[model samples]
Target: MKRQRAFFHTLRLPRFRRITLPLLLLLVFTATSYSLVGRQTATVPLPGLVMIDAGHGGYDPGVMSNGILEKDITLAIAKQLQAALQARGIPTAMTRDSDIDYADSGTKGSSSKRSDLNKRLELTEIQQATVFVSLHINNSTLATRGGAEVFYSEQNEGTAELAAAVQSELHKIPQMSKRDAKPGKYYLLRNQEIPSLIVECGYLNIADERARLNTADYQKKLAEAIANGLDSWLQKNK
Candidate 1:
């Protein structure tokens, strides 16, 4: 009887030791992992919402040349831009998703245009956007003049930086013309309280540019470049 009791006691101690050691190790590992995860989460910055405005729609076709309508092109590029930004975890809102304008009922001529623009401006505040980007297609009498240009309002301190960032990325495109970001007295940019800029994707009067802008592939490239530029600016400013 004494021998049997001693044998059982020896086995019990070994079993207890084995279970207790592993449990303690597990607790330590779990605590370490949580600490690392917390640190990573705290270091990452949150991005702000961007307001994208497709320049013209509905009755307002903006500048048209070479069988291309400005309203159509703007909406296409805007949608692509929204997708690209969202894919990178950036929040975005569009002024108009369809071929429609914001003008109120019975509004006509210049009044309609003003009403439409005012409504678009109101969205920036409504969406609580940190930045505003207006997409447009340029037209010049000289057919030779082509390429994307970025314009910013001098009223806002950060507008120039945002424009420069986007302009730099657009310049990297093989088919895009290299142009410096400039200040503009545009209605949208002038009234914006936040950082606002207009990106003239390309000249519609230019044959080659018009053809490329009409294609889905080129529009995607433009959207991607704009997205990269916005991402770059956000990272630095955030």
Candidate 2:
């Protein structure tokens, strides 16, 4: 009885009351904020703002053939895509605006590669992007395989729709022809919690395709196609 009375007396004190009430309210607010963030992260079919990742940079040249480098093409396309999206008043973010990689510039081996990828992931989260599109050039043992291919992860529910929308637009490009969307196991796509897809602009192994990809006019066409596709998808989603 004495201890209970003492406890009640302490609560009645001005100092204790002032400190305790504020602390309790703060704890409640923090918990509520954390719960809301968790729910947002788990929700599917993200909408608003797109993220563009230009794959391979710095020491990584990616696929190289016939004096052409994959990294250059990827960056070119990504920049074009960013511009196209911005022109239409759509918000967008790019992983890289230059030839350098996100990883340490002078470091050796795969550590830098890993660091670069981790940075890209962090940016994607910070932006809270609706979808992630990684731009890259394709390569194969068979030189005959040419044309654009859009690949998406099955884990994200909206990725299939995103892939279809982009793929359909890519096909309209005279260079891309009628290539279809494919399922892929790419690290960026698989790890991304949002709707994600990879756009292989063209196969570098093919002679004519390589020549075309190297041209500024063809790159612009490719960018326009992807932009149109994104616009279509956004319309349907909205």
Native-vs-model 1 lDDT?
0.78
Error of 1 at 124 (Å): 1.2
lDDT of 1 at 60: 88
lDDT of 2 by residue, 209-229 (tens): 899999888888888888888
Candidate 2 runs further than 4 Å off: 1-47, 104-108
Tens-place lDDT per residue, model 1, 18-42, is 3467775765465321122122111
Residue pair clashes in candidate 1: none
Model 1 — TM-score against the truth? Answer: 0.79
- Scored by lDDT, model 2 comes in at 0.74
Q: Candidate 1 regions off by >4 Å?
A: 1-47
Q: Which ten residues in a row have the lowest lDDT in candidate 1?
A: 3-12
**TM-scores, each model vs. reference:** 0.79, 0.77
Residue-pair clash count for candidate 2: 0
Instruction: Candidate 1: count the clashes.
Output: 0
